[model samples]
Target chain A: MVEELIIAGFGGQGVMVMGQILSYAGMHEGKNVSWIPSYGPEMRGGTANCSVVVSDEPIASPIVTEPTTAIVMNRPSLDRFEPMVQPGGLLIYNSSLIDRAPERTDIRVIAVPANELGEEVGSDKVANMVVLGAYIKARGTVSFETVGQCLAEVLPARRHDLIPLNLEALKRGAELVK
Target chain B: MAGRKLFKGNEAVAEAAIRAGCRFFFGYPITPQNEIPEYMSRRLPEVGGTFVQAESEVAAINMVYGAAGAGARVMTSSSSPGISLKQEGISYLAGAQLPCLIVNMVRGGPGLGGIAPAQSDYFQATKGGGHGDYRLIVYAPASVQEMVDLTLGAYDVAERYRIPVMILGDGVLGQMMEPVSFPEGSEPENAPQRPEPEWATRGARGGRAPRIVSSIYLKPEELYKHNLRLQEQFKRAEAAETRYEEVRTDDAEVLLVAYGTTSRVCRSAVEKLRTAGVRAGLFRPITVSPFPYKALGERARQVKAVLTVEMSLGQMVDDVRIAVAGAAPVDFLGTTGGVVPKAADIVERAAALARHGAADQATREGIS
Candidate 1:
């Protein structure tokens, strides 16, 4: 099976990092994965997005024009990616920031109050992690345990102190989705 | 456990070049490819190698020439416009028969184009952008893993032929991150020393004659002989280094010919075509210069039509047509100015080509 996604948000919202973490989780589960950011000038502000592909077999293209899933953490992201989700696919957005709901009726849309939940978990810095947790719950593409293990691999030793907080964020967000 | 680590394509290439015993890197900063030199700058110092962010692309390539001349494995990388700036030096290196790695993380270009990815440099890379009759062996990697493998392999190919080798990647490949594993026993921290070349400009010893690394021949006849020698070397490389990947081409009614980023899209397209009951296959040339013409020619004999898909207007299509040699009608589908064609569209175009055999070449519209 293959799951293609776009994770989009502001430059500081950890959109690329979320995509990378998901890719790492896919790798931890012994799957082929790729993460391609919208680099250059587009990455300067709220237009930051990354395309991610996770597959049982070799991944062909890292690009996803029509993603099966979209994790939009801001309103601009919601505006940009809501319609691009394939029919019957998932659109997980941060409801704390986006006011308007996705207009598409053909897709599954999950409105997670990611910022509120991130604050509830400990820090608003983990907002992307909260969205990621919801993404894991909604898609089940990679296990939470695999994501935690991937965190160990991705987080530098100097930043190891934050792993528990991030893990708490992941768990709390997943609990919200449940 | 699988030996895998996540890496951005440019960073992976830098680490792989280190693993390949490249002790020197000289490059200028360019978007979509800056990570290469940035990684090298950090890592090379720890390994006792050199990383110089030269003043300009011209200076950087000349430094590569100097380093390669001293028998050191060296590399330089840049985006399309920067790469164009280094053409004069590249031609000089080619003429002098120096071995070095040059990376072109191609961006959209005619002059300082946008930092978005494109394969518009196809002609500039494969058709010898520099003056004089010479060709640099070009490797087009579709994945980050291939980015690592081909970066390492490019050094070997360069050294084997005493010529410059190019890794022609687009911004898409350079900026992407993927899981990759280097070869077994290729630890980058303490890379093994590569043997110094006998022809290197090392200080003369043991009463041996001093070697001259010169590309200038005063006489026309002498220059003609030198050109012939270079051509012979190129021919040898063509015979030995024509690498390609053919997927599901045995009974395909249509063949999609692509390289680099475009090839990856075509691979996805092939899967879609199969689901739609279309007999489509892909012929991806790993070496863009020694371009798997023979293999493509053989596949062309079996396929009803050949569709050349690229991120450019249609540069590589000329080579595809030459390889197909009228065995099958050749068609083209591509974009330019950094707009990438979608895989679904590639499938649709190929399927139409499969059904209709071949449409008029002039009727094909460029995907914006």
Candidate 2:
């Protein structure tokens, strides 16, 4: 099956990193994947998004106009991306930042209080990890272990100490689904 | 020996240049191309190679000139605006007939336009940007792999003709990531020793006398002879340095002519056109300067029409017209200021041109 996802939020919200983690996990699963970023001045304080596609077959165009999954980290992100999710697909919204849930009934919506979860985890920056945790729980696109390992591989060397914290965030996020 | 490793195109170019025995790198940092200098800064010193972050693009190109004069395998790179600054230096290098590689990871421009991918420098690259009647061998690579391969070839060609060579690319090709492999044992400890320079400024040793390398000739007759000699070398390059690639042109009724990133888009367009039952194909000129005119001219005879697609407004189209020589009608489709034309749009134009080819008056009108 072909799955496309878009992770979008404000520039410094770790949204792009969330997309990279998902793409890295997809690669770890031996799937064909591509990640394209929106760069230039559009990335500064403005809304930023990355389009990632993972497929069992070769992907034709890396440009995703309509994605199968939408991960919205803020209200603006939800407002912009909710309409582009395919019907009956998945939408993971950050309930702490987004004031309202998506109005669409055709798609499955999972409202995760990621910022509160991050606060409980002692760092609000892990809010993206909370969203990613909920995504793995909902889609089972990859094993949580694979996502954790991929995270350790992709994080900067100076931040290597954060690996255990990030893994804890992922596990705490997975437990929220239970 | 083909194994894949993920890397950005700019890093790939630096790695490939190192593998191609390029030991001297002089450049200034510019956006979209900053990764190139960043990579070289860390890697060159590890291999005992030289990497200098010049004070400005002018200083960088002149430094390249100095190194090339010393007969070192040297290179310098910058974006469009910086390349504009380097034009005078490039012209001087051409006049001196120095062998060196220069790279332009082009960004949007007419002036300091923006830091976005653009192919607007087609004319500046192909038609000698600085003053003079000289040509620099220009290679445009469509992918990261070609970026590596063509850079290696750029050095070889530069040395063979003793002329400056350019690898012209856009920001997209520089920033995008792809799998690349390092050529095995391709690194040279140093550049091959050049034959004793008859005109190099080698300082006098043991009263063997000092040689001077200058483009300045006070007398018109002397300067005229110098230019004549340069022209002869250009002629030899024109005869030997033309490179291009063709796809499905044997029975094509319409040909899509493009280069670099536009060529990849056109390739996709050609595939779509063929799927839609139109006999359309692609002709990609690898070397933009010693343009593959003979091949293009021969292909023109068999095709009904040629469509030149570029990211610039009709710069490369003129060259296509010159190469086709009225054998087939040449049409243009272009975008500018960092806009890239979609494959569907090119396919639509290709299909339209093919369907109209049979109608004589309609085709003539379409050309006009």
Candidate 3:
């Protein structure tokens, strides 16, 4: 089965990084994977997004017009992407930034107070990890252990000192579903 | 050997150059192609190679000229406008018969166009970018993995031909991430060492005088002979290097011809046509110059019609017409200024061409 996900937000919100982490984990698990970002001026201060496809078969188009899952980090992202999520798909939104809830009943909407969770975990930057945690808990496309390992490999390369805090944020967010 | 790693196309090209034994890189920063220089900056030093961000594209390409003159495997990269600035240097390198790799990760253009991907530079690349009769072997890569493979092949072709080669790609191909295999072993041992240039400005040895390399020939006859020699080299390249791919064209009634990213779109179009029971196929030219004329000419003799798709208004379409040589009717479909045509549009265009062909045949029968 093909599992397609889109991560979108402002340029600096780590939305692209979240997609990269998932793509890395998918590759690490030996699944066929592809990561494609919108290039050119769209990547400036404007909204930016990336499509990640993980599948048992070869991927046809790396550009996903309809995604099965979406992680919206901001209000603009939610408004832009909410209509494109497939039926019965999952959407994890950062409720701290996105004030409106999704209007659709055909999909699963998980609103995580990602920024507040990050603040509770001692950093506001780990909000992406919090949203990622809620996504895993909701969909189970990838195991929490694999995501943790991906986090260990990718996060330290960018921010070595924030790993433990980000890990804590992930666990806290994941436990919210339980 | 079986593992995967995430890499942008620009980074993949840089790494592939290193694996191909390119020891010197000179480039300036420009949108879409900046990653190439950045990758070279971080990776060159680790490999004990040289990477320099020159002050301008002009300077960068001349530095490539200097390095290539010294018998070193070298490369230079830029985007559309920057590549225009380097045209003079490229022409000189071509005139001097220097072997080097030049990369253009193309962005939209005319002036300082937006940083979106475009294929508008096809004419500049395939038709001798500068004011001379010289040609650089130009390769258009569709994906990030082919970006690596083509970059490596470009260097090898340049060395083999003793002429400059260009890797012509769009920004989407430059920025997308894909898995690439890092080739095993150190650099190949059998590459021809840069010949000691009697024409290079190497430091004077003992009593020997410094050498000079220039393309300026004042005498009209002398310059004419130089042009003829360049033409001869181009002919050799034409005979030796035409690379292309023909997909399911055996019984194809309509040929969807394209290159680079446009070729990928045409592949999807062909699949759509197939599902609809239309006999459509794709012909993709990997080497733009050394233009694959013979292959297209042969296909034209068999196909009823050909549709040329490109991101530009119709640059390669002109080449396609020339290749077909009146053997078949050639049609053109294109998008410009960074707009990419969707697969559905291409398929629809192909279907229209098929209907037009059938109508034309019916008219011929009515006349008979």
Candidate 4:
């Protein structure tokens, strides 16, 4: 199985951390994965995104032209990436931040209220985790346990104190999407 | 696999240098490659290695010269514009025959182009970015794993040949994260008992004749001889290390040539073309300087046409044309200013070349 994904949001929205966790989870699951961020100047106050792949086969190009799944957490991200989803693919958007809906009918669209779910769980800053949780539950690329462990690994030691809240946020996201 | 984990290419390159026994790092910070110096700053001290964040790129490269002259396994890294600043120092390193690794995680530009990935520096990297007739062993890695492997290999090759070596990557690879591991089993170390090279400067013990590490040959006659000697050594290095990798070429009708990040795109294009029944293949030159010219020339004879792709406007294709040299028709495709070439684009070009390159060329000639 191959899942080419583009996860996008604001710079401080933990978009890069989301990519790192997924890629780390993919690695721990014995899959060939790669994650590349949009590190250009366009990232200043713009949609910060990253391309990630989880595949059973060895990956060739890390650049994703048309992603099989585009998990966008903000309106700018949705506006930019909504058209780049492959036909018959998945488009998961955070309904909390994006007011408008995705117009593409060719692909599956899931609207996850990540910010609302994060606030209910603990903090709204875990909104990125909520969307990531929705992605994993929808795609089933990696196991929930692996993703949790990778989340801990991706975050520094000081952030380890917040694992429980993060896990709860992830669980809320997973349940919301399905 | 015990130590395998996802690492950014720049951080991995720094760690790989440490594992390769590099004792010193000299560098200044730049975007897309800033992690290299940053990682070195934090990690080098832990391993008893010195990390100098030089005031400027010029100072950093010259510091590399000083460390290498003392026979330290040393290195420095920078992006496009910073690398441009270090060109004169690189030339001096070559002129003096000092062995040190230089990592160029190339970003866009003729000037401060962009903090986006590009292979536009191909000409500067393989064909002497500095001045003079000196050459560097340039390795262009296609992946983060290859970045680690080539970085380890680059130091060894540099020391063996007493020449500058460059790991020519791009911002994409440098900023990307992928699972990478150190070489399997324990890598043998350069023991403390390892004898210093005959040319290394050290305290005078037992009154051995002092050796000088100067590139200046005052007399034109001496400079001429030195240039000849440098050329002869380069030829030997070329013979010893001209590496490339070929895939799906056994019955290929069209061949694609690329390196570094673009090579991975071409590899995907090869697979896609095969699915479309084009019989496409990829020829990736791992060592872009001592480029696998003869090997590519031989493979060119087996194909109907050759297409060279790059992130620049046809730099490496100059080398490709030299290698293919009348064997087959050569075509070129490129993107500029950090725009990545798509795999679909490559497939279309290769398919057209395999299907109607000859007929199309003939028809156009007839019409004209």
Query: What TM-score does chain A of each model score against the native chain A?
Result: 0.95, 0.95, 0.92, 0.96
Ranking by DockQ: 1, 4, 3, 2
C-alpha DockQ of every model = 0.80, 0.22, 0.41, 0.77
Better of 3 and 4 by lDDT: 4
Please give fnat for model 1.
0.78
User: CA shift at B217, candidate 3, in angstroms?
Assistant: 2.5
Give the docking tier of candidate 4.
medium
Q: Which residue pairs collide, candidate 3?
A: none
DockQ preference between candidates 1 and 3, better one: 1
Name the better of 2 and 4 by TM-score. 4
Tens-place lDDT per residue, model 1, B31-139, is 9899999999999998889999999999999999898888899999999999999999999999999999899999997898899999999999998989999998999
User: How many pairs of residues in model 3 come into backbone collision?
Assistant: 0
Rate residue B267 of model 1 by lDDT: 91
Show pairs that collide, candidate 2. none
Once fitted onto the true fold, the runs of candidate 2 whose alpha carbons sit more than 4 angstroms away are A1-7, A18-36, A42-44, A51-72, A75-96, A99-124, A129-152, A164-178, B187-209, B360-368
Instruction: Give per-residue CA lDDT, model 3, range A1-178, as digits (tens).
Output: 6788999988877888788888777777777777877764665468888888887665544556568998898899899899999899888888998888889899988889999998998987888888888777777767777777777666656686677787788787888775
Give per-residue CA lDDT, model 2, range B245-301, as digits (tens): 998898999999998778877876887798999998899999898898889999989
TM for every model, in the order presented, reads 0.96, 0.84, 0.88, 0.96
lDDT of 4 at B186: 31
Which segments of model 4 are wrong by more than 4 Å? A42-45, B184-193, B358-368
- DockQ measured for candidate 3: 0.41
Where does candidate 1 clash, by residue pair? none
